[model samples]
Target chain A: MAIIFSSLNIAFSQNNDQGQLSGNFSVDAQVYKEDLDIGAEVPVEKMGLNSYANFLYTRGNFTAGIRYEGYMNAMLGFDSRYDGVGIPYRFITYRNDNLEITVGNFYEQFGSGLIFRSYEDKSLGIDNAIDGLRIKLNPYKGVYLKGFTGKQRSFFDFGPGIVRGMDGELFINEIFETLNNAKSQFILGGSFVSKYQKDEHVTLNLPENIGAFAGRFTFMRGGFNLSGEYAYKYADPHPDDPSGLYNYNTKFGDVILLNTTYSAKGLGVYLSVKRVDNMSFRSDINATLNDLQINYIPGITKTHTYSLASMYPYASQPNGEIGLQAEVIYNFSKGTALGGKYGTNVSVNFSRVNSLEVKPTANLDRFETEYFAIGDELYFQDFNIKVHKKINSKWKADVSYLNIIYNKDVIQGLAGYGTIYSNVGIVDVTYKLKPRHTLRMEVQALFTKQDHGDWSMGLLEYTIAPKWFINVSDQYNHGNSEKKNHYYNIAAGYKKGANRIQLGYGRQRAGIVCVGGICRNVPASSGFNISITSSF
Target chain B: MKKFIVVILFLSIGISLFSQSKNVPNVHIKNLNGEIVNAPDLFDGESLVILSFWATWCKPCIKELDAYNENIVDWAEETGVKLFAISVDNARSMSRVAPFVNGRGWENLDFYLDANEDFKRAMNVINVPHTLLLDGNGKILWQHTSYAEGDEYELYEAIKEQSAK
Candidate 1:
């Protein structure tokens, strides 16, 4: 390592400039000593390391770069495919005259990324880089066209399926000469993506072609702006559906999002709704659990900051679900009764999702019928609300309440488990000391007779200026039918200039980590974690 | 009059070509000192510059950087080379870059940042550590998507060959 660093220094120093060359790298190493078996089934590990690096150089309209990744001992709950090191991306790209081309691994997103999204989430160990060719063309002002054909990455390797897609977008202001000066502007876009994989008498015969398409429209006029997209997909079957009821066929689904915000003076309000079906967009036709993910689903439940409130975060069920979210942000005008001296900011948001009602026909063989009949029953639902108020310059407070209904059987594919209903409440307060110091406290409680039982949580955080912070939190399962479990953690961090270090010791419960709607399971563990970062 | 015509034709062609190139938006990135810097200014215009994002714990990243280090001087002499090593370590583990670099004795790399990932999102960087190559004109030239063992040699050859042209 020392020799490598010296060589790098010499390389950078000597190549001061001919064209540009720069790169960055990082490594995360952890030592884990597993305790007695709890709910976890995987073997306990002693240590693990996850690291990767990227290098790039460009001159003129041409650019070249590559990435290296290694996972010596994969993390718990993560797949082992990433344990090997190799080059995941290698390609040269050029852009000139409104045309851009890339040949190699690339990430892209169309619209809300609901149906077609090729992206990477390093923290969650998710990557779906497409190894192929991509092209973007802007034929005229405001008109954009994009197309790509590639195979998705599976760990250090590529998946068997081939993906091809095309999308077109038209910006109204630029496309319609007459609309350039209009008070209201509009933009529209549409996309279609298809995946092909050969099948050979697997458990079942799956469709070789699976396709998804979406159309989006956005209108902006004064204080009112609305954007929405409708996406649909053909039937796609998986090996998990033993009943063969949810077999791959030409399945139809759509996600409609309508966001309208009125911001005038100091008040704002927004509303959105989405419905999705069989939309678990992934790269590997067979990749499961922290592997080969290609798209994201939007979660309807609020992402709570408190431990207990976050314990049961709703992971979007891609196969079938409808969700709605609404939020209002209102700021009291200065000198108003509720505004106080500095004015007051108030916000409230709520969302819920449920499985589509499907009715199944009897007498038909279980394997021959559909997984769900039309007009059945709801799968899940959640309602939440929050209020935030600043009492004074030194103090601020927020309170929230949530009610949720989760179907453990459907969401987790676990047998013998029924639906769960839970109610959760949280309150947070922050106090300011002088100019650079602050302290925050959070208290939360969750009541449920469903999965995991009732729980309570508390967290405290203290920060001093730009360099130091300390946080402590605890979650206690007080109403469990089995033995009550208490989870606690304490962490502190210090930073000086570009360098920062953090130390943490804690006992944590397993939970789900989700982005957009994709998710990965985090295992329960108790240990010490130290992290150091610097640049220069 | 003929000379004037020729100049006009040349200017028009230059303008047309410039218009054809995609405009890369400028982004603000934090330096090792936590100070913000414009990305484009990192290149001094005299030599070919390579910008890479990496971390100490990443094995492949280490291998790639080490490979480049071995032949970087030769590549530099053959075609003026400059390299910037940007670390995307988040707030929790960002302090280790300098020490790690010192430990590795990488004398040729300068450090940059995407601490809050503002630069990453702007550049649409989805995976790490990813690399981006830029030309002296501050225009993105060629970007190899990812790296393998002998990939650095290929990169060096490309740089050398391009600079010579």
Candidate 2:
């Protein structure tokens, strides 16, 4: 790599005391063509890249890091076994005053991660880092502990299963000191993950040590808050299962979650609920899709950054479902009456999902559920609303509305597209035009009569603040009765201080591209792109 | 590839034989009532701080935190500086970040939540309307990563040039 960046640029100009060396870099390339009326395809390395870089190095308490990823032939729905790359991730750590340790690759989450969570999300190309030991402790003064035993990356190699976990938490008023002036507060946690693969199936006889467990809690006071978690696992069946939608059923799985919140001064509210069943904890259980996902099913809806209201999004199925979501927001102060003169927010959201009642037993490979029932098929629903406003000082706006239904045969398993209602609307605006210039506009539509029925989009942007920007967009389907493609794009960008670069030309629309609710499946092309980012 | 060049020449010779450190690296975020909090105890060595690193479906990180919530109370009564904002919003949008920051009233910015980004990978933030500018013992005297529209007046002139040193 160019002699390791000229020996780290000559040890970064003879170093500033040798340790701190922050990191960050990104790349994204594309060049494809060959559009056959939107069924775009053209690979054979017609051009595609996806690079990454991370270098980290601290000092006090010691730290070390490395990450370099490349996917010269893996973009356009990623996963080409990530073509080529190395340095999957590296790490080393050491801490003090309360102990901390790490030994190679990491990323973790326990409490609300359901059972466990190892992270990374280069826009849904997921990382799932976790390669060896990890430890964290505080020993008291509010307690907190963690442990690990990794093996889960599966792309640049690793993932034949061998994961272990542990977690702990507590903070009932920072471990009682007269409850720290108590005003209602508490936290509690617990977790225990497990895995170990090696059953090389040959007539079924699995369960090579699988385990899972969870518990969580939280509660606050002023302005209310709540939290919850639950988990359980044991029977995980796989052997030759690649999204055959799980069927070697040995059952035993579970999940549950809850969330709540409330606010004051200008309103705010939230709610969440989940159920999942047969959790689908992967770590190579014949991993599939955003692979090796050892927990993370959140997605109770409401994550739509509009683009035709995120076109029927709401993955989070994890085998079985049962969801919920709610939101509020408000605001509206500046001179009341739906707040105007620069104060008017709004919000309002809703969500739903279903299916999870289960039935059938008597030794047919296990099947029984009912605890917290709720099923009748209908996997997804949404309702949205937004407002946001600011008039003077150069105008601002953002209107919104959504109402999806989706269930395209249980979320894209597509089969005669069962339910697919839709209804979207948007309108953005900006306009500053001077103080460093700016202008923006957007208008969207999405009504539907069923699969690929109606759609419309538009955008226009211009900026010149801290750097520059340019945008152009289009998206039409105009109630396609057969075919009515029209997905255009034009982009430009520039930024300094931390660097950034962008360029584009496009027409790419093949669906499913999520992050957070995790998803991926971008196909359809006609491109020319470039992106770059940096940090130091 | 030769074990990746001997693991990059043994981590660049153990990063040129280590030695350097500053503030902001205790990582462990969560405020907004979820508690936790411990990112260098929100710097206090003497003043001037400003984190950022946003999310909630980033839109220029809600327009650079709504322009620092419209001038963070005259920049914290003229130079007390503070601004936090964190929020990497994982777990699928982290329960809509406290009703999207109280429906965008932004209540004078302070939110937190790094959900699994672990203080955004211990401050090497990979993207999300970044922004930093510590001082008060935490070092980092200026950082930026994306966000336009008058970039908050050059981050309040780099916090009034580091609070006039």
Candidate 3:
């Protein structure tokens, strides 16, 4: 293996048209030292590493690639199911003007992913890439059709169920040349997906086949645009969840999503709504948490990056939830009182999610729900406004305020931890010493009486030109009447071309680290971490 | 165990002969109006293009965009470079990318959404705030991962170096 890899690396040169080959490698590892003070238990191996390398060889109209991942005992927050090493992804592809085909491992999605989506997110420890066959055909102009049949990956293995999906899309405007020139454009799409698994339980009979269908449409013109999708799923009863709150009774599912936006020049407004009911489609019947999600319902609220503002983020509820999100963006013109010499940008956003107003009857296959009814229980709400401006050539600042009602018990499954009602404020500033050097700082605070009480955080970062950076930050649970634990970290990074290396030593607070709408719980720990990534 | 390591290494570099700047894959991404455009078309092979791969939910991504916007006029006037901010937001948050960019009044930048992450996976991007500098010939001359407070200065330098050539 070493001989082959060395040969390839040395053999490839600046020679261009000879069917180029490309790939990248990355590795992240952490060495743990038992910290009794912070409850960072020592792993049996004393260390954990996660590494992956992808190689793709493309020539002419054909391409093939493979990904190898190694997790030495897995990371602390990662799923232990990925304890070993294996080649989890590989694919061969061929494409032409009329048709495209792929075999082996692939990722795909239909419309808003209400019915089916196969993708990977290493941060969330979620990779459900399908292993099988996929085909795409454009038989007619302005029309796209795709179909796939495969089994979803579970850790190092494939799920027992075999899932299949088909999607078709037609651009109305393009299909009809007359409409193409019209001011308003339209697009129509539909999808059908299903799963089949063997029924093996002896005590209870279960449906081995579950299917869903969805249709979507969009219209856009000028500054106004609108789109929506409706989906329905066959009866799927799973009463054996770990929580034991759901009934094993047969149940059907449905979801509806609508979004609209209007924008021109410096002002824009957007509104989105989603309704989900009994929509817990999964590759595995009993998969829990961040595992086996066939469909993703992302958070409608803003994604806050400030340490304090994002402390308690909203988690999307794919099953039996209704949500609405609204946002407005306006830029005050330059040279105005509010705009200053440089224009000032102000953005306001609001989002809310609640339980669906649905009731179940004694019927064997049906549930009841009003089309627009909203449940009384509140899951999450976020209201925030931010203003950003450049004070001078060398200085810039941004200030933001956020109000949130986070249901920890419902979202994080913390039984006794009630909903947290908090308000957070943050100020970020950047100063440039020279054209090649700069410094940035952030100060943030959160006020709340629930959970860990009030909190505050501060961060400072310095950068030299493009290749070097160093930073330090700390968050304190100051509102806690008893414990005032400090979560602190210091890190640095160096970059050259497509290669980057980062090192850090820090104490992380025990909490849920979420990306997109998925999350992973990380335990409290103090350790040294190193990461190396390069692309060619 | 040694054999396994060797197999892994071989699989990673089995076909790599020498390292060269590979062209951006011909993946498809959608613009704000939901029109599919080839990924390489953004650069078009005739102009210096800066592709800033970002997401609405990412803070550093936003910061980098803001900084670039603040310096865009100057950057363009000085180097005749155009910037395209590609939002790698999936189906869940894709609807917000356009609105977010529009609301910020960053009209200086163009926005495209990668709904399924095809471009991201094809580009081998593991994180956001990853920026790529392309020459007039559509060759990716330089790329960087992560953003610091003053990374734009280095980017400008790279742009100047490319434009000079």
Candidate 4:
């Protein structure tokens, strides 16, 4: 721990030119003690810590960087595979004129990331960087090409399977001399990705090579824009489906996505539709959580912020589902009827997803589903509306309402538990009495007769200038009747320049913590958490 | 472990021997129009530039930018400072950024999208509402993370100092 701090101190102080050396460090640790009342049990290590520091040095057209991660027996919900620590990420690259190359680890993403995406998310405990070689070539002005081949990272070791991918994109408008100033622009691209593994099964004969291909396009005009992508994968076998509907033989998979948007001065509208079937592609056939993922199908639902409103976030149904999302936003100009001294903002969003209609096959290992038809079983649905208004120069208010339906049977992997229909309402306001001091208040309520019944919550936060902030909040499951639990917490923090330290103590009720569309269930516990962050 | 310490000391000494230059990274970001644009080229090269990394899911990030928009027209005249609210929302939530900003009528500030987080990672930004102040020469003057009610004043002060110089 001391050595880690020393390296951070050195990194934070050394920022200069002629090959600049700079980086950032973040460390999160907690002290956990057994709490019988809160169902918090003691772990082998009483103190758990997660720390990371990144150092980057760049000179002229050359760059090098390394990241050190240490998870001393990761936290409660995190996977134990991250028990040890080492330099998991290191890369060196050079870029000049029309060509560039990287010889170590790097993150890359293709169109919509449907066929290939390599990234790292510390919060979600995901890091699947490719360790081999990658190259990019701009042979022409409007043409871009990339190619790479490597093995995926699984925890501290590399996976057995090897991956190879290639992508090429062209800007039609830029490539053609006659259409330099065309009103509508066009961009086209294509990708091919393949993974290789040895056939080791005695009873089943598996293919040594599995491949996926994708083609995408984009068209943009003055105020209208549209983009779409279609991907198809060859037969591959895997057995980690939460649905538990098909588990034997492998079958082909496919995904289709299309989105369009239009915006004016004070109004904007957007809509997108997606359909996926057996699209869980990974390097390792049986990997779970966020390991060895070869593609990412972004969720099509609006991400809510308020606690109650976001209680049931929709994770993308990668296996098989069809979903549609639409949103409209309008702003009334100042000095108008709806817009008073300032203005009024209103937004409405709607989304729905359902399972695929599949017909049973002879072997029961593969299934068939149509491309366009909607299924009967509902996977998730959300409809929400929000309005914001400024009452005066010192006061502002916002109100929101959300209605959501979550299929617990599929989302939470609960066999017979049924769907959860919840309605959330929130009221948030801020008041300023002094030049550098302000008080904000938030009150929210979740109404439902299923699951844990009704829940009510409120929070108060006060801030002073640019240095200090204090917040306290509590949520009560009032309608449970059996166990009306009160999850209470208080936190205080101080900030200056690029440094911040926060101390929090609370009873963490059993729930889920999500980041970047990934979810992790956290067990209930009572303890103290300290976080320190600094960058130079 | 001993060799690690030795390497660290040598690196520090090497870093101290060289001086710094005034150049910001030439990263690319997508605008609301879905067109890729060089980050440092967004400004006209003669004034202070503010990069306020934000997200659609963060509440305070939205508030601080709203405050900047409220007094921006007048503030721009008083001090030649510009603000670009870079949304670090991925594809999962990036599509809504355009509508959200337009819905709020925050058209004064340029709303750029870092859909892939390429620029965010280039700046070593771990969280949203992280603000950076750059000079006319493209060198970062100062930066701060998180936000409070009066945080804007500190930014204004920094801009004032640069203009005075």
Candidate 5:
């Protein structure tokens, strides 16, 4: 640990004009303790640590970078395959005259990322960067093109497949002078991605080459905007038993997504609808649990901030699902009747997802489903409303309410348990005691008759200007008398410039943790933790 | 480990011996119109630029932006400073950013979307609500991570001081 800190410190302090040396480092370590009351099982090491450092250098039109990651025994929720230390990512790029070329590992996305997106999310323990070559060309003023050929990263190595893709985008307003100042702007884009794997399986034949294509369009006029994408995939078959996400079947896949938004001075409205059927595209047919994924299907649901409200978050089902989401935001003037002195902002959102209605065909490996029909199986539904108001110079508050209908059996892949209906409410208040001192308090309550019954949580945080902060929070499950557990935590941190250090100790509840709709399960545990982050 | 430290030190010392100009990298981002714009080009070399990296799902980010929105009018008029809010929302929640910002009545501020976090990586930012202050020449003057209630005042003071210089 000292060695890591010392190296990072040296890198942070060194600065010169020959070229810019900029990098960032972070270290997160935890010490586990035994607590049988929460069904916590200690690991063999009894400690876990995750650390990463990124060094990026840029000179003229050239940039190079590398990321070093180490997971000492891995964390509770993270995959155990990342148990070693190595430099898993490295890339070099050069840009000039509207042409950019990159070699090594890089992340790329085409259009809305429905059919092809390569990215890295540390929180989700996902990094599917492609290792090969990528090129971007802007031949004309309004035309942009991208092409790449690479292999997906798979935990310290590369997947057993070769992926290639090409994308083109055109901005109509810029292409023709006649539409330069048009109120209605138009943009069109398309992408084609394919993966190649070996055919080494017996008893069943597989198409060694599987390809997916996507097309998207955007229309905008003043305050109204509309965008949509349609994608189709060739027959991709994988053999996995009854326990995997993709069963042993051979079928084509397709998806369509539509979204629209309208906004004015103080009002905004958004609506989105999507349908997905057998669209799970992966570089490796045998990989599971967020491994070697070649495409991304966005979850069309609101991501709640409150702990209880997010207790039963929705995860995108790529195999087959129909989802719709709508939201409205309105702000009243400062002196209006409902706006009070400081005005009020209110937003209402609702989202629902259901399984795709499919009927078996004469072929055992294929099923048929209508494009717009929804299945009877309910996957997840959430309706939430939030209001934010500033009472005075020193007082501000935010209140939110959420009603959720979660199908645990489907979302969490469990059995026996049916749907879990829950209602949650939260109130957060902030008070400025003095010039540089502020305090915030939040109280949340969740009521439900299923699952773990009901839950309540409270948190208090105090901060002093741009330096120090302390917070204490507790979540209590009082609805279950048989096993009432209290998950309490206390932490403090200090921040200066681009550096922050935080230390905490608490009992963690076992549940699904998600970031941007990607999720992973974490086991309950008790531990002391510390994290340090700094960038130069 | 000792050998690794030696190599890193050698590289740092060797690299520090050279010199070059410093300026914001020209990273491509998208405006509300879905057209690509060079992020560094926004700095016109005449006014202070404040770039705030935020996401729709983050709470403190909203609070910080709201605080700035209240006083940005006065600040801009007085010091000729500009504020640009960059949303790092991925595809899952990118569509809501526009509505969320307009709903909060923050239309006065310029908004850009870094859907793939290209600008974020170039700046070496780790978390949302990370604020950076750039001079007229696009050189980074000051930066801070996280936000509290009164942090905006400090930023405003920094702006005043730098503009005076």
Candidate 6:
């Protein structure tokens, strides 16, 4: 080990003509008690720590680096196989001109990460780094091609499967360089990917060849832009349902995104609709959670940052779901009746998702269909409107209302009763007392007859910029069939340069934590918490 | 009926207590190969130990290990440390552990396995590629939840402070 370290130093010094080396490290530790009854099945009752270090030496186009990770006690809601110390990613890749190649662990995403997304989410305990060879070729001005073959990362090991993929994209404006200054700019691309695994079957016959293809086109012309992608996957069967009853055959998923903006003034409007079916593409048909995931499905719902607003976030059902969302933003002219002195911003958004209705036939299975029709009933719906205005030179105000209909039994696979209808209203106000001091207050109320019932919340925040901030909030479920639940939290944070410390004492309710498009169920608890992060 | 009610009450309270959050348990155990040995002893004053939890079948884990093997020497010299690469391979494949490490030529890392999962459970490990950094006194100073290619530089900076301290 000592010899290896010496050699590395010498090599880095020799390669780095400037003789400079840099690295960084971080640690995430959590301590809490577990409630075994109504919470998640698995819980961590002790202090868990996960840490890692990274070192990189770069000189020009060449870059080299390695990382060491140590999981003293892994956190709950994570896979247990991550409790070792080792380097998970290392490589030295160089780029000269338009051709670049890398051999080792690397993360890549293809086209909005719909069909393929190999990345890392530290907090979620997901790292799907591909270990193999990757090559990128730019033969001409507007054409690019990428090819790679590797195995998907599974916990501390690799899945018993291999993946190979190739993608090509052409920029229309670049292809016709003379059209660069044209009124319309366009781009088009296509990609194909396939995964292979040995099949040992006896009862049912399954296709060993599984392939997926996608093509995208985008056009922009003066405040108007449109983009669309059509993706399809071949037939694939799993052993879990050997009868091919719940399997997917010849599945197809497509997304069409249209964006237009007239920034000449102060107003913006965006609308989009997407329909997907049987696209839960995975490397291993049997793998679940942080396993051999081969593709990603985007959730069409808005991500709420507030505690109560995020309570009922929707998770994308990859198998079959139809989503529609439309949003409009308008800013009134300043010093007008609706705008006030600083002007007013108003936004309205509506989104709804429903399950794909399917009718079973005597001779044909459900999986054989390419497009499943929508059911008669709706699965989920949300309509919200928000208004933000600067009331005065030292004061600002925001108000919003949301109406939602959520189906617990269908959406969340939890054993429950009927649908829930909720109406929520929020009012927020902020006052600037001084240059570095500000105070904010929020009041919210939720009225519902199903699930947890009616609720009320209040939050206060005090901030001293570049130094400290404190927040206190409480949520009370005053109306419910069962027991009334009350949740409260008080947190303070201090920041200096690149270092920050946060401490909080609070009682929280059980809910789902969703990042990107993935979701995890987090239980409820009351405890004191502290976290410190610093970088030098 | 009374016993059943008590059980229900206990379960309900337990669920309610942890209904909103999860707890990661902590335990003390030894990383055993063919013999039993305490893990704390491995961290001497000379160098900080980078304990990474991984398995032979996990490709990402292997990628991380291979990455470390390729740059183990440089990391050691830059931060003056060593890596304690432990495998969470169960008893069924425990015998295959040493050979896999040898094949990778991971000489800079001391190979060990927690076949029984006692060490894993004690460490509250929920996933692979989990890592921890322990000071010479065996106290955990810094840690990270996951790994990326450039994350090692951040880890090295953390260790340099502890080593200097």
Please report the candidate that would top lDDT against the real structure. Answer: 5
CAPRI verdict (incorrect, acceptable, medium, high) for model 1: incorrect
Candidate 3 lDDT, B54-123, residue by residue in tens = 9987877888998898788898988889988889888777887766777788878888888888887877
How much lDDT does candidate 6 score?
0.64
After superposing candidate 6 on the true structure, give the runs of residues whose Cα lies further than 4 Å from its correct spot: A1-24, A34-45, A239-245, A248-264, A363-373, B1-165
Q: Local distance difference test, per candidate?
A: 0.64, 0.83, 0.82, 0.82, 0.89, 0.64
- Model 5 residue A116 CA deviation in Å: 0.8
Give a tens-digit lDDT track for model 6, residues A379-451. Answer: 7788988786777767877788888887777667665567889888888887878745778889998888888
Q: Write down the TM-score of every candidate.
A: 0.72, 0.33, 0.93, 0.93, 0.95, 0.71
Evaluate residue A329 in candidate 2 and report its C-alpha lDDT on the 0 to 100 scale. 81
Give RMSD to native, each candidate: 13.9, 25.8, 4.8, 4.2, 4.4, 19.3
- In candidate 3, clashing pairs total 4
Q: What TM-score results for chain B in every one of the models?
A: 0.76, 0.32, 0.83, 0.83, 0.86, 0.73
Indicate the TM-score of model 3: 0.93
Poorly placed runs, candidate 3 (over 4 Å) = A1-11, A14-16, A242-245, A363-367, B1-22, B70-82, B135-138
Chain A TM-score, structure 3: 0.96
CAPRI tier of model 5: acceptable
Error of 2 at A464 (Å): 15
Q: Across residues A255-338, which tens digit of lDDT does each residue of candidate 1 receive?
A: 555555454445555566666666666555676654555555656554454566666666777667776766665666457898
Candidate 4's residue-wise lDDT over B1-165, tens digit each?
788878877775676465343355555687876665666576566788888999988888988888888766766788888888899888777777876787777878988998777777777788788998877656677888998877988888887887677
Would you list the clashing residue pairs of candidate 2?
A: A453-A479
| Backbone clash count for every predicted candidate, in the order shown | 100, 1, 4, 1, 5, 70
Better of 1 and 6 by TM-score: 1
